[model samples]
Target: MVQVMRALRVSRFGGPEVIKMRQIECPVPQVGEVLVRVRAAALNPADWKLSAGLFQSPMITLPFTPGFDVAGVVEEIGPNVTGFQRGQAVIGWTRRGSFAEYTVVPAGVLAVAPANASFGEAATIPTGASTAWQGLFDNGNLQAGQRVLVQGAAGGVGQFAVRLAKWKDAYVIGTASTSNVELVRALGADEVIDYTATRIEDAVHDVDLVFDTVGDATLASSVQAVKRGGTLVTIAGMPSEEKVQEHGINVKSFGVVVTSDLLQNFSQMVDDGALRLLVGATFHLEDASRAYELCQGGHGRGRIVFTVSK
Candidate 1:
């Protein structure tokens, strides 16, 4: 008999209403890939945006699943795949889509899930945490003793940015709404500015790195906070090229590159308590419509996760 699975499908592109639950075939792992029995899947801005038809990608088609991150147990391995066994817990960026009871992930991107984190917490890493990790270390080249600013410090990626920067011994400043100011500080930000009342550029200056998880207006103003020679790395919108050239500073907006090394580092940090994760809300697979709605609503405090199993 053929096997089937439950998945959140986007049959049409428009709004959160486009997403619905559907019964689908359980994907089989191909060579260099593994089929994961998903425990949880986390939402990213791109996920909902794709549902709303915001991001352009030739690969996106109707009746597709909408997720990038997954934490699950390995159910099967494919040809030429090694180092992973059936039933091993793992977390990864599937890219193909993960909002399902089963999803196939490339073996190269998979990492052993952090033992200390629940599936929900581990789910936050693939996209959100990795984005923060790469922005600071890969793009910004932030070093110990340097001063760094985290834009939207109470956000999913921002919390990871603050914790990771501090673990590297950098002096970390964070911008947040008043409601989350204390949360950002507790995450180890050396300074937390309530962005609602104070503009980030005015409160601090001459930082070595500005790690922007918030873009647009906040990112535009954040440029001045960087020392003339410092770097501005944004995961959100990009600043104009002309404006960057005039500032005499380095600027980069990078897509997170997920490798076993990067994933392991994030897992190790979580295990060591140098980093932590939070799931602002969790919905079962059947409730994905509501999950998509909340994620699209914006200004959420934690990662939105769908607990697919257990």
Candidate 2:
């Protein structure tokens, strides 16, 4: 008899109501992949957006699982894989199959979990922190002592951006609602702008980099804050090439790149107390619908997670 695992599946694109749980075969690891018995999984913007068909990329197939971040114990490894042992705790980005009891991912994306953090907290690292690392360092090319502004700094991705920038020794400024101003500041932001009370342009200007996590009007406003030769990078929306050329500023919008090295570095950072993991709320595997609902609201405090086995 084949073993079965529970997973959240989206058969059709719609609202939070569309997510449903189904019991399917427990996946066997293929060559160069590992089978992780998921202990916890965290939510990202893509969770609800994909569920709503808003970010329907070619990579997605119908009736697929929604989660991208997972923290769990390695249950088994496939042929041609080495260095990881069974029962070791790990966290990494999944290929869209993490909202389940068991999932398989390429070994290249797996990294040892931080010894100091819980499964729920570890689950938050893969997508959010990797994006932050790529956005600030790779794409934005933020340098130490340079001024960097993180737009919407209180959200999931924004929080990590602020912390990572601070880690790199950048002078960090962030924008958040009044409720999250102090929180952003406490996360090592040297300056926190209450976006509710002030326009970004009015409060700050001539920054070396603007890390915009909020798009649309906010992203448009952030360009004014960047120095003439500075860089503006956003994960939320694509800036027009014309706008970037007209201002003569480097602009980048990109998806997260998950690598074993990146995940290992993040784990070390967490263990060394250089980075903090914030879990705003958690739900049982059965209550995933409720979890998705809260995330869809776009105001949940930090990472929203699902406790799958623990």
Candidate 3:
């Protein structure tokens, strides 16, 4: 008899209410693929945005499972797969289907989970951490001794940017609500600005790099904080190229790209105790709708996870 597993599926895009947990046939891995028995999955803003029909990309089709990050155990390996074995703990990014109890992901994207991190903690790394890393290093080209400012520093990507920039020897400044000021500091930010109180432009100036997680006005304000030749990297919205050219500064926006190398580096940081995972809350797979609602609620200090097992 074939076994089946439960997955959260959205037949139509709309609100959090569209997500429904249902039983589906478990998939078997194909060549160069591994079937993961998902232990945990992390909720991200992209999950809700995609669910709400905000971000439409050719890579994501309708009537799909809506998770990008997963941490679990490999249950099966497909033909020609190497460097991975059944029953090994792993983490990776999935195009879709991670919201299910089992997902078939490319073996190349899989990496051994950090020994010191829980499955829930490891689940939070792929999308947000990779975005923070790529945005800071790849797009912003932030260097040591430079002053950096991170908007939404209490958020998943923002918090990781703070720590990663600090690890690279940058002087980090961050913006968050007054409630999370200390949390931002603990993440290695040298200065924490309360966006509710002081204006971001007024509090920070001569920044070599600005990592903007909040789009719209916040991204616009970031341009003024960086020096004339500095860079502004946005993960939120694309800025006007004309506006950037006028400022004599570099401006770029990025979408997170996942690969085996990126996942491995993230795992190494966690293993070496250079990075910390912040799991704000967990929901059972059955409560994935609630998880989406919570993520959309918009004040979470860290990643919200969905547990598929245990």
Candidate 4:
């Protein structure tokens, strides 16, 4: 008999209230895919943005699951798949259907979960960490001994930027609210500026690289923080090319591209104790809507996860 599993899905674009938990037939793995018995899933701002009808594309049709990051045990492998076995712990981004009991993920997108982290913690890595990794190392060209400033350092991607910048041996300065100042500092920031108390323009200057997770005025201010000929990388939005050239600063905008190589590097960082997952809260699979609500509430200090089992 075909099996059915619980999934959180939405048939229309709207708020968290639109999501519904329902039983759906389990998906089968295809070539180069693996079916994961999802133990946990992480929430991202993209989840809500997509749900609210932003970035609509042909790939994302209506009545879909919103989660992207998942950590789980392998339940089955598709034809020609290698390097993974049933019952292995793994994590990756599935384009859709991750907020379910089982998700079919491309084998190349997954990596073994870190030995030190629980499924909930591991689930938080794929999206936030990979975004930070791409923004800092791949695009920003952050180098050791260079000064880097991270705006919004308390959020999911921001905190990972803090840790990864420090791991790269860059002198890191981060801006956060007063409540998260110490949290950002503990994540290896050499300096923490409370944006609530001080203006970023007044407090930080002469940075070699500026990573802006918060856009708008914050992104605009970042151009001024970097020294002449320095780089400003924004994950939220691209700054104007004309504006960048006027200041003689190099500017780039990035949308994260997750690959096996990136996931492997992140797993290695976790194994080496250089990276850590900060889970702000966890909800059961049935409460997936509430999890998304908490994430969208904009007050969460870190990643929110949904436990699929146990």
Candidate 5:
């Protein structure tokens, strides 16, 4: 018999109102795929952006399930897969969508869950942390003892950027609103600027890297914060190319790439106590509408996750 499962499907591009929960057939794993029984699914701003017509992609089909990060157990493995076994706790960046009881994950992106973290905690790491990792080390080439300025320091990716820079022995400066000033500081930031009180460019100078998670005007001003030959890496938006040229600095933009190797490295960090994982809020899978609403409105700290099962 074909198994039926509940999923939060985005039937149309709109607000949270467009997300509809319905019973859908469980997807079967194909070659190089694994069927996971989802224990938790983490929500990203991208999810809401896609639903609300703020982001457009040719790959997004209508009536799609609305998540990427998931923590679960392998229910079955498909042909050509190896290393993963049934009933093993795992986490994945399921491009197939995770807002369902089960999601089919590309085997290359699945990793065993971190022993030290819960499902909710594990689910948050793939997207936000990887973006931070790629932006800082891969793009910015950040070095220890150098200074980093992170705009939107209290946000999900910003929180990880602060800690990762600190872990790399870099001095970290972060900009957040008043509510998140202490929060960012607590995450090993050497300094926290309240964005409401001071301009980032006015407060800091010659930073080794400016990692911008907030775009628009702040991204423009961050060019002045970097030292000559330093780097600016943004996951938010691009700076004006001509303006960047005059500053003698390098600017790069990237989207996070999730893979089993990356996930495993993070898992090791969790077990070694060098990294901390967090979730701002959790909802039942059936309450996905509320989850979408909260994520769309913006979260103050950590990732919002859906607890799909025990």
Candidate 6:
């Protein structure tokens, strides 16, 4: 008999109400893939966004699991795969099906789990940290000693951005609500603006770069916070060409691209005590719909994760 595992599946685009927990066949690893018995998984905005029918793509099909960040033990490895073995602890980013007892991960995105973190903590690193890394360094071209302002500093990606910017010796300023001001400061932000108390443009200006994790009108107004020759990078939404021309500064946007090398570097950082993953809340696999509700409501202080197994 084929092995089966419990999975959170979505057959339609809607809200948390559409999510259904069901048992599905355990996937076999294909070439260059590894079968992971998922111990934990982190939730991202992309998970809910994808579930709501946004970013519709040809690759997505109905009745598929929705999750990206994963931390687990390698249960099996496919042909031609090397450098990993059965029962090794690992973390990876998958396109889909991470909210399950078992998932098949593309080998290119897999990495050894950090020795210092629990599986739940490790699960929070992939999507948020990688997005922060790519946004600040790859797209924004942040430099040491420069002033960088991060909107939504207490969020999953925002907190990582603040810490990583500080790691690079940049002066980091962050915006958060009153409750998160001290939280942002504890993450190494040089300055923290309470967005609830003051407007961002008035509170921050002349920064070398503005990293906008909050998009919409917030992203549109971020141009005002950056210096004339500065850059603005957002993961939420891209500003239009008109805004770019009017602002006269470089503006870019990107989604996270998980790589083995990046994940390994993150693991080393965790082991060396240079980085941390903050999990705001956690739930069992059966409570995934409620987890989605919390995340979608946008009230969590950090990443929300699902603990599949101990």
Per-residue alpha-carbon lDDT of model 5 for 1-310, expressed as tens digits? 2399899998888988888889999999999999999999889999889888787778888878889999999999999999999999998998788999999999999999999999999898888888899989999898999999999888878888998999999999999889888888888899999988998778999998999998888887899899889899988888898889989998989888988998889889888999998788889977778888888766367789899977
The runs of at least 3 residues in candidate 2 whose Cα sits more than 4 Å from the true structure, single-residue gaps closed, are: 240-246
lDDT of 3 by residue, 24-114 (tens): 8888888889899999999999889888998778976878887889999989988999998888999999875798889988987889888
Worst 10 residues of 3 by lDDT: 238-247
Tell me the tens digit of each residue's lDDT in model 2 across 202-259: 9888999999988988877788899999989988887667877777788888888899
Clashes of 1: 0
Best by lDDT: 6
Local lDDT at 256 for model 1: 79
Weakest lDDT window of 10 consecutive positions for candidate 1: 293-302
lDDT of 6 at 156: 82
Model 4 per-residue lDDT tens digits across residues 277-309 = 888788987776687788887657778888887
User: What TM-score number comes out for model 6?
Assistant: 0.97
Pitting candidate 1 against candidate 4, the one with the higher lDDT is 4
RMSD after Cα superposition, model 1:
1.4
Error of 4 at 65 (Å): 1.3
The whole-model C-alpha lDDT of candidate 6 against the native structure comes to 0.89
TM-score of each: 0.96, 0.96, 0.96, 0.96, 0.97, 0.97
Better of 1 and 6 by lDDT: 6
Note the residue pairs that clash in candidate 4. none
TM-score of 1: 0.96
The C-alpha local distance difference test score for the whole of candidate 2 amounts to 0.89
Error in Å for residue 283 of model 4: 1.4
Work out candidate 5's RMSD over C-alphas: 1.3
